[model samples]
Target: MSVLLNLREAHPALHTHPTPVLPPWPRVVVLPANRSPYGLDLPLDGTATVAVRPYVTAHEQRERRRELALATLGLDTPGPYWIHGLEVA
Candidate 1:
């Protein structure tokens, strides 16, 4: 069986969340384990899994700022505007 199948059988709680909609090939940033402020306790083999929480929070902040800027310019920001440029996936 595949890893997903194993995970599904071993941990049901992991499947509680809805499937996240992501691009076919998403960008990946690999941070060196020594440089990472997290995952220090884990036995990392030179790389660390970066947290998405910071990136998500930053994206939200950027969106709010864009809205404010648009509002100041007497224009309304669209409800679901596609984010362009580096989105730090």
Candidate 2:
């Protein structure tokens, strides 16, 4: 087990189940659209996982994520959106 995982097991008061890190491959579908969203078929094998909650205390660490997320064209934030998903084999 990783040291972080061990730490979580040791301190229930300070830690919790982390997020599942999805395998970088086996794509997870993200529906990004305003006019009738479409489904994306991910290639996931369904075994990979990521942390459930944050393991870090700094917000700066996540800044890169936000920036990368906004890199796509024609994407604007702070908008009305609805999302629902289903998974199948």
Candidate 3:
């Protein structure tokens, strides 16, 4: 079983708005299961999915925006990015 949490609703300050539009290849941040305060008693064997819309770096945002603009003008957009399965140990 997998547990999912919306960090934005849980800790708004940590996930402030104006969420950046990520590029085809974006950075990922992972938090360990033991670090969560709310899941102290939960089984460590299960997996947890931390859904977060992270803020991208300014440069990344600019690049993504530029791609969007080109797309709006009927130009070729960037290639797709895949989200492989998440692992919990």
Candidate 4:
């Protein structure tokens, strides 16, 4: 039960502009359970299959979390998280 930012919509300019491509691994950002962006209180209580490959680095993880927190306007809090590349299976 987690929320994920729709990256494509979040940064349309970056997504559509000509920039060096980044790997999908770094694009995944999962919000903690019971948390959702401001205004859109979407319920997340359904089961969904997912596969994850853990990828972590203390510095990088912290930075990523911080960035997400700012982007979400504090709706997302920076906290402990093991970065992972996830795929819906």
Candidate 5:
């Protein structure tokens, strides 16, 4: 069985974005400044259906696995992701 990974709360500001139509669900993750877009680049889809809870919240930053965050925002949850950057590994 695919076990859901644990996630830690983080600052939303860290998720520097370029404006997106969020579906009030999926959590947004910001990639580092030095990384370019290529892998883990998911665009926001208007017709997404997923209840996104707070993967991480402000003042609650903690270490998390990369795969877990991906699953939460990837196909599993939705908001169109509304993300602009990738999470750390």
Candidate 6:
């Protein structure tokens, strides 16, 4: 069985919601564990999972443009996006 299958069978409550519009500023995302290539030693402990699809906001787009402009001028100081873990669930 696939990870998605295991997730659904073991956790029927796991449902996907429509992706919502993100804020103009950068937000954080907590990535779930890998659930691919079935038959791994992974286990789902009765927890539900959610997937999110994020799009670039106008402000973010402008920021990216600014960053690119700075990079062209050799003054780029871009920050990294962090992916947190879901331990509480």
Q: Using lDDT as the measure, which candidate wins?
A: 1
lDDT of each residue in 28-80, candidate 2, tens digit only: 88986655245445555656865444646356446535644664554545544
lDDT of candidate 5 over 1-89, digit per residue (tens) = 12322221334455567777767876788876764457545666757866545765422333234434766876344333223365332
Candidate 5 vs. true structure, TM-score: 0.15
TM-scores for candidates 1 onward, in order: 0.30, 0.17, 0.27, 0.21, 0.15, 0.26
- Number of the top candidate by TM-score? 1
Better structure of 4 and 6 per lDDT: 6
User: Which candidate do you rate higher for lDDT, 2 or 4?
Assistant: 4
Worst 10 residues of 3 by lDDT: 80-89
**lDDT comparing candidate 2 with the true structure:** 0.55
Superposed on all Cα atoms, the candidates' RMSDs to the truth, in angstroms, are: 30.9, 35.3, 37.0, 38.0, 42.1, 34.7
Name the runs in model 4 displaced over 4 angstroms.
Answer: 1-56, 74-89
Which has the higher lDDT value, candidate number 3 or candidate number 5?
3
Between candidates 3 and 4, name the one with more favorable lDDT: 3
TM-score of 3: 0.27
Candidate 6 backbone clash number: 0
Which pairs clash inside model 6? none
Models ranked on TM-score: 1, 3, 6, 4, 2, 5
Residue range with the least summed lDDT across 10 consecutive positions in model 5: 1-10
State candidate 1's TM-score: 0.30
What's model 6's lDDT at 65? 73
Across 3-83, the per-residue lDDT of candidate 3 in tens digits comes to 335655667677566868976876687867566666667565534665445565667677767766776797854466222
For model 2 the TM-score comes to: 0.17
User: lDDT score, residue 87, model 3?
Assistant: 26
Error of 3 at 85 (Å): 16
Q: Itemize residue pairs with steric clashes in candidate 5.
A: 9-56, 9-57, 25-52, 31-85, 31-86
After superposition, candidate 3 runs with Cα above 4 Å error: 1-56, 81-89
